[model samples]
Target: MPPKFGTSGLRGLVTELTDALVARHVRAFLAACPHGGALHVGRDLRASSPRIAAAVAAAARGVGVEVVDCGAVPTPALALASTGAGAAAVMVTGSHIPDDRNGLKFYTPSGEITKADEAAILAALDAEAAPAPAEGALREDAGCGARYVARYVEAFGTDALDGLRIGVYQHSSVARDMLVDLVERLGGTAVPIERAAGFVPVDTEAVAPETRAALPGWAAEHRLDAVISTDGDADRPMVADAAGRIVPGDVLGPLTARLLRAAIVATPVSSNTLVERMQPGFELRRTRIGSPYVIAAMAEALDADPAAAVVGYEANGGFLLGFEAPAPAGALAPLMTRDAVLPILAPLAAARAAGIGLEELAAALPARFTAADRLQEVPTDRSAALIAALTDDPEARAAFFDTGAAEAGLDLTDGLRLAFENGEVVHLRPSGNAPECRCYVEAASAERAEALLAAHLQRLRDRLG
Candidate 1:
């Protein structure tokens, strides 16, 4: 498939993202966004990232835009540094997708581009462009990674995680070393485990069964208080408790917000419903799935009340701070982009502060449990047809669910979400970044949620077959 805009960025198979194609997109981005000064470029640990990032830099320089290479850094680190310098950025990362695929994430000086910006980029790709008279200079910026770590240390204090044994699952994540550095700086024993030399596409949202099985063994062997890791670019976090039980992102979002004492929180409709029940003191807004939608909703909340402490998170565990919030050491400046660091650190700090284990801290949340998985290699058109059929026919929906209970509520915000009278919830949507059909289910117990997800996914697989 050709490189095209997805939920977060422009993505396609690695073979499809040729140098010529990458250069064209970068030039189009420069034309549409119109950044006057230097542009920042960063890449993940993927083998193809360096070559693609070089292509991006060459293309930007061709258009007379100074390029600053922030090599081999997390997505948020590059975003923070470029935004601070008042320059736009482009990250060469496929995030949590497979190694055979890759992508480009664009950021304006202000922050991430909106859906309108996406359309503008597409339009600019074909429009005529003016030639530049001079070539631009390219330089390197190596301190962005350290500065990103400093942001958290200064806010939460070096002793925020004092006396904790945290396991860092360094599974080829770009932020693996940074995570270790951050944890150690914050007064924790950073036990580096499972450090893979090759790239690993560890999707935090729909974790694989092998990874799910491995976490517990590692945690037990290391006697870790918790295990933490991130996706390829380190934007989405994966956190497991002492018992190796994974805490979903929806659970982490509300807990982190409560820790920050946020006045307003925005999340996608597909997130865990427990957020509303857990954080009744704060105003909550639900948007469609994707960081762009969550960021837009957060911006709207801040517009309504500038002084309000606004934050956004997705089911993938990427937390976005929309406002400055007070911390022990100082205040955390807003970085209105999806971040994994804050969510990971906040819960760990909070658990230690309360003199409780990570397991105990998570158990205090509402009993609702959520489980998500996907049918991989499924065609997008097939998934869309399935959703459209279920949406148009009530009987089809009922038959698909195979539950006798009536739906108490129905939401078509981003996908087909139905709340059954039995207090169970199920949602279905096609993966925005890959060829997969995802299903999310929530129930009073974890077993029930997993069972429902498995049954529904089997049904989908059988239908697609």
Candidate 2:
């Protein structure tokens, strides 16, 4: 199978991402950009990342570009350094995917590659490849990582998290050490746990059941105030309260926005509806379910009002700031790419300032809850056909939903989102990178949301089977 760009970046099974294939994609990317400066290369802690990074570096050298080895850094760190230096970068990571899967994310000098950029890269794929260099001179750069760490330390100050005892779930996330360092520097007791030798794909949005169950036990063991973690690439955060309940990203996004005093906030349509009701004073913009869409919306918001603090976040808790905002400690610089640390630390700082626990801050929001699950191995074409039939015909929709009532409304922005008469929402879309169908549900309570998602997904599974 050929590696392709997903909602995030290029991803595929480890077996499919052969060195030759990665080199081809890297060559195409370099050709599309036509940059002469050093191409910064970074990787995560995935078992295959080092090999993949070597392939990308070789490809860059083959195209007569220098390679700056930012070695085993977080994706956002690579983006920050590359954009600042006006150089392109390629990060070897599979993000939240399993260990058997890995991929690449390319960033231009400005930021993440736009949809237009993806098209250009894809167009260049068939072009004649440049001659491979027998040996490529690779320069190692250790400053990028430190600079990334300093960004938070300076913005939030060293005492922002004082008196907090935060547990760091040091899974195979590349940012594990950085998070621990940050917490300790900020006067918090950083308790590190669950340091895994192998890669662990920690998806913040739809956390694994076992992970959810262990959080409470871990919290009790360490007497922790909260637990913090990130996805494989450390671009998305997973934060759990003292009771071991993970706060959904949508809820955390709004809370972070409120803490930043953002004037305009952008998020995906699949985010919790509570965001709309909770942050009444700020302008809320909803886009399609992808970072690119959310980033574009945030850019528009910032362009309209340059002084307005515009921020965007995904349902996975990756926060993006379009402009510098007032932090509790100081002013934060704009980081257009998705970042895990800011969301994790900012909410904690806000809760501390408010003299409340993270759980209490989350509870202050409206009682809307969202749950998501995916039907694996469902073909994309079949998922598309099913969605189209359900959207085009009310009878089909009613049949699928098992309700005789007519559809309340239909939203086809990114997928088939049906709003029923009973104030429940169900969204169905094909996974961008994998052969799966994802379903998201929002209801009045946590139990209802989970029940809705379970019932809907079970129905989908039955139909697919």
Candidate 3:
């Protein structure tokens, strides 16, 4: 009964996002769908995801909905099964969250839920949703995984990566072997770090600080192009340069967007640095944040212009749906989830075609760098109040003009954003995808950017408090 609809989907701590809660979500979702003959359920490698998926499966089957358990597969695979099977799907994934967190996202045949449907689902959840008696038995589906790998092979053929040495950091990541297989099939030399069978908490951005220090040396020793890895779900990507510094998602996204000529449908929380450097007519549309927002926008765009939109990705470096044009191998349909493998392979292909390296191309993108951080005083309940108060404040209004610049505009589509003269800007918004109240800042330099962000964050935090 909290907000069932965030930018992406309903997500919360495992404490509240329990099996009972997900049961309610599943019941409401099935009730909303028109032709729910079969429901596809998949989960990530998260410790809690399997449990949640079981609950969701039981809940759906309890309502007479046939269930196809796709097992531990990427979200894209689950989504593809739903769309391919012409069935409703629910993914039990916490995607990139710290342990102790989990979430469930629903798809109604089209790979995503509409805002209208989202509101309805929340309303339904607020009311009691008793589990109905089992209408159908749950069955395991093994075909989804093979179909998933086939989709990737079709999109990115093995011709491009004939011989390149790559090392996939094999922490407890699900995609560790998937990536290795993809690389091998693509004819790349893949070296995987030995992985344990247990769960590994990997934060795309919260990469181990030691990895930072070791990255460059490792790249030099191994002579690698990039350190490609994913969070637990394999939905979001985290890349390290040959020197081993984690490339921020904001930076990685546009690179992939530009490479694929991706007419991006992204959220405004992402930095506009890519906008400044992109080629003329590099199409982009900003949604709020999360895959659902971007996915909904892409659906609309595809409806309008089908072939022109090659791919859709996000600033979080989640390469959403993409089209794998006809290859020598076969026809490839893009997956509808935020995929880690695509971003890795796509940009590397770009660098290869351009006769450059990932690091060098990264250097040329743009000067602007944006960072996402939460103001300590601003919590979930207070974020909305802050954005509303700041946007309507008389003093804040006057202060805006004081920074005075001609030919600049305001962008609050997702957050309280004010674009300034020198590309120095501030964004105060709630993390629609997560709990924290986020404030973003981009400036001419790192020091100035941090300072400006800190000052602005302090003022908002004080005000919110």
Candidate 4:
């Protein structure tokens, strides 16, 4: 099957992401652009990434555009370097997907390409093939990574994390080393843990049970102030407190916004409702589930009030700053893309300022909790039909949920989100990049959320079976 744009970028199986196909997409992305400059390319540590990055770089060079290879760097780092240099970028990574799959994320000089831009690129791909010149040249740029690191170090001085002892779960994340170095440079004692020798897809949103079980033991062994990690490309963050309890991104995003003193916060509809309660002082904007939607909403908020301290985040904990906001260290420049480090650092700083531990800081947030899981290999058409059946027929919904109570409300912004009279929430959306059906549940307690998610996902599994 042909690759298609998902919530963030183009994704497909590794076998499908051939050199020719990647070259075609790269050419199409460039063809839709108004100007041509050196294209900055980066990749994750996925086994296929090196070859794919080479193919993309060769493709850019073939189109008469120079190629700057920012070897094996995080997606956000490449985006930052590209934005600063006024050049477009391409990241070869599958993100949290399995090793057999891979994807490409394209960025313009300003930031990530919008949904509209994806349409244009797809259109260009269908029109015609561009003639390739004898291959151009590819230049290796080792400084891009250093430049990205400097952004954080300069903003938050060397002692920003002076009193903290953080554990870095180095599970094959592209930013593993960078995270360790950054924490140490900020004066935190960075203890490396779970350093995997092979690629492991760690989903920040729906962490594996085995990994979750190991966290507390790891933290205890290291006597950590907090445990931090990221998805494969390091665009999404996963953090745990000293006790080893994971802090979901939705919660972290709002807390980070509060730390930055944001006047406006934008998040996806799928995020926890607690964000609304915790930060009642800020204007909260909820969009369909995706960074592009969040980014667009943030842009609108900033346009309305240029001086507004605006930021955006997703349920997966990827944070975006639309404009600079005041911090204890300095003003953070607008990255306008999902970043892992800022969210991880901002909360630590907040806890330090409050003279409390990360656990206490999390406990102080509203008491609502969220849990998510997915039924793998679920066909998209089947998932759509299941949702339509429940959405359209009250009896069907009652039967599926095994509850006689009527629905309190329904939200179809990006998926089917149902609010029961009992205050339970269930949101179901098909995976954007994989053959799966994702289920999200929120309730008054973590146990209840997990129970509901388990029940709903099992029901989905039964239906699919």
Query: Which candidate would rank higher by TM-score, 3 or 4?
Result: 4
lDDT (Cα, 0-100) at 40 in candidate 3: 91
Q: What is the C-alpha local distance difference test score of candidate 2?
A: 0.87
lDDT score for candidate 4 against the true structure: 0.88
Q: Which candidate wins on lDDT?
A: 1
Residue-wise lDDT of candidate 1 within 125-240, one digit each (tens)? 87655677788798999999999999999999999999998999999999999999999999999999889988898999988899999989989999999999999999999999
Residue-wise lDDT of candidate 4 within 1-465, one digit each (tens)?
Answer: 357789879998899999989988999999996424779999999999999998998888887888989999989999998888899999999999889889999998889999888888988986565665656567888988778888888887888888899999999999999999999888899999989988999999999999999999999999999999999999999999998999999989988888888888899888998887874567889999888899889888878888878899999999999887777778888899999999999899778777899889988888989999888777778888888888889778778883234689989998799888877789999877787789988888988888888888889989986
Clashes (N, CA, C under 3 Å) per candidate: 0, 0, 4, 0
What's the candidate order when arranged by decreasing lDDT?
1, 4, 2, 3
Off by over 4 Å in 1: none
Query: Candidate 4: which pairs clash?
Result: none
For model 2, residues 1-465, the per-residue Cα lDDT tens digits are 356788988989899998889988998998897444679999999989999999899888887788999999999999999988888999999898788889989888878888888899999988997665554568999988889988888888888889999999999999999989989998899999899999997878778889998999999999989999999998899999998888888888989898888888899888888877874667889899888888889878778887878999988899998888888778888888999999999889988888999999899998998888788777788888888888888777777884233468888888899887777899999888777788988888888888888889988988775
Answer with 2 or 4, whichever has the higher TM-score.
4
Which scores higher on TM-score, 2 or 3?
Answer: 2
Worst 10 residues of 3 by lDDT: 398-407
Reference-based TM-score, model 4:
0.97
Against the hidden reference, what TM-scores do the models get?
Answer: 0.98, 0.96, 0.86, 0.97
lDDT of each: 0.91, 0.87, 0.70, 0.88
| Cα error, candidate 2, residue 266 (Å) | 1.6
Which window of 10 residues has the lowest lDDT sum in candidate 1?
126-135
